[model samples]
Target: MARIKETFDSRAWFMLECDDPDCERRFDDGQWYAYEDDLLADAKDDGWQILYRDEHPELERDMQYCPAHRLPECSTCTNIMADPAGWKDGQCPECIKEEIPNERS
Candidate 1:
């Protein structure tokens, strides 16, 4: 499951963070606006199970992570979302590849 950290900026816009210990992706205007309406819905639809939701009063945002999506139980596989190998430049290379499939035959 992937953990999402939600915080409010000065303008009251929702700021999101991928809270996986190894993941450094943060969601601000670009991600927020694009998935504002379907963030949770899409997550749910993708078979991601929410482990828990926490409210950070000091941060002024709700933080939630889906262990099912970010962290899997496979012994041979590491958390892809975390990108522990540093192969991704703050972006998951595997995820990017999955998003844009290669058309080459």
Candidate 2:
């Protein structure tokens, strides 16, 4: 969970943090907003990314990643991997391994 959502005095307060476990970047508007869209706009203005699901374009992503670690998700399995070497033909190593035949047939 990169963003913290809190309600105070009938208003919303947001504090964003980098999703990467190694990165320690954070953002706080320090002001209450009337609507979620307002806070989201501010978050984007500050370079925070709002990732979405590749398979389901209508569904918004639950997790947020910083500019540095905004890795691509595997097409077969929606997993965000840091190492590019794990990707081949837009699929992760594990997914590719699963496709391989167990025995030479």
For candidate 2, what is the lDDT? 0.65
TM-scores across all candidates?
Answer: 0.29, 0.49
| Per-candidate total of colliding backbone pairs | 10, 0
Candidate 2 Cα misplacement greater than 4 A, ranges: 29-34, 53-61, 73-105
- Residue pairs with backbone atoms closer than 3 Å in model 2 (clashes): none
Over 4 Å off, model 1: 1-12, 26-29, 34-37, 46-49, 53-69, 72-105
lDDT of 2 by residue, 1-91 (tens): 3477788886776776677687776655456556667766777787776654673354455566666766676776766555558677777
lDDT of 1 at 68: 30
The lDDT for every candidate, in the order shown, is 0.40, 0.65
